[model samples]
Target chain A: MKYNYLNGKLTIYLEEELDMNSCKIIRGVIDGYIMKFQPYELVLDLSDVKFMDSSGIGLILGRYNLIRLLDSKMKVINASKNIKRMIELSNINLECVQYE
Target chain B: MNENYIKIESKSRSENIASIRVGITSFLSTINIHFDELMDIKTALSEAVSNAIDHGYGQEDTESIVTVEAWIRDEEKIIIKVIDYGKGIEDIALATTPAYTSKPENEHAGMGFTIMESFMDEVIIDSKINEGTIITLTKTIKKRKSNSKKVE
Candidate 1:
């Protein structure tokens, strides 16, 4: 639920559990930020995610699609091994998603 | 091989997920389940609860209840059952298939069952179209050689 913009890149530090609950709250607010800042390269930091489900995948994909609409790219950062497995077992399209 | 059990019934609300996580994680942590194993259980629990709230009640009926039962069968085994008395899936086989979800529009990748299967040693989904669904997840915790029953 937090983001930092530096050097024209937006890095979002998600320190919350990326479950259905956080997704709901995040979905409500992301658009506002997109409209306001309109950053092209976005990084999602999930180092502090306590728990994640399929909804977490949806959140990333939804944001990916959203940023895609803006002709931007979304890169992932600090994804745990379990989160990586979740994303890999999810939709094949997301298999190409990068993590750092 | 000491026995411990906990049963939790909560309204099908997303907010309650936190409490469920805290409860389960706290209990299992006391049993010396490793951090990664705890993460696996928490992830599976979230998926199960999410299924109950989203697929079961369609995330609308706050009156409906989601039941979670956890049984520590022994030092090395844990069983959890997540049950929902909401609309159940007609095809269990198809439902368990990878990338199969009725709520793709909502960004569900149909990885709930996939996740539960990966994290737990066994996952059994029992459902009937009108009755309800019960997903039983069993994980075998890696046995740590310790006679200390109390978490100190």
Candidate 2:
């Protein structure tokens, strides 16, 4: 997971399969940054993510909660058709995270 | 038509996960699984394996083996079983429910079973507390096969 900060927004770029291991590392890294920088907006760039299991859903849900606690907004960008379907089936609110 | 089977028993540690997907892909690819279907199976299959490690074994020991088996049934469908001999679920019905995780502190979304059911044609789970758990996943793959290989 690579992250870039621009204009008070943090954009996280995931380029690999987001599984349990990756999720753990990302949580640590992102949480550390959240504690330090406290960005107002977070953009999850899943355009490069080829595969994600249920754990990936957990990552998003967990992050959503964290960001909401900080009064920040979180958006998912460029999720593949596959990831989008999984999120829909989970019954999570479609409007909760934007997929563009 | 072609048929084959693969059985691998490896440690439940996170480090040994790559082979599960690699082996499944190699096997399903031979039978011509569609790209979309293949991607679905890979995600579902990993979720099962991850469940076996997280729930079944409780991540207590790194040596316990999680057994994964796949059978290509006459080139028509693929059957996969992920088994672990560790602590099992007391109530499978509740466990299968969406958003129910035994390990919420770990951020387990509890969508493992849900994802498996969505991607596969069928999913059957059997568990015995303190004994083990077995998750069976089935999916059909035929789009890449030639007309000559069609059966029935």
Per-model DockQ against the true two-chain complex: 0.79, 0.77
- Candidate 1 lDDT over residue span A1-100, tens digit each: 7788876678777776778888878766766677778897778788888677888888888888888899987788878888887887774675436665
> Candidate 2, which segments miss by more than 4 Å at Cα?
A94-96, B145-152
Question: Between which residue pairs do clashes occur in model 2?
Answer: none
The residue-by-residue lDDT of candidate 2 on B9-116, one tens digit each, is 899986567678888888888875668888888989989999888888867678899999999988878999999999998999999999898899999888888899
- For each candidate in turn, give its C-alpha RMSD to the true structure in angstroms: 3.3, 3.9
Candidate 2 interface RMSD after superposing interface residues? 0.9
Name the best candidate (by lDDT). 2
Which pairs clash inside model 1? none
Per-residue alpha-carbon lDDT of model 2 for A18-68, expressed as tens digits?
A: 888678788888788777778999888999987888888888988889999
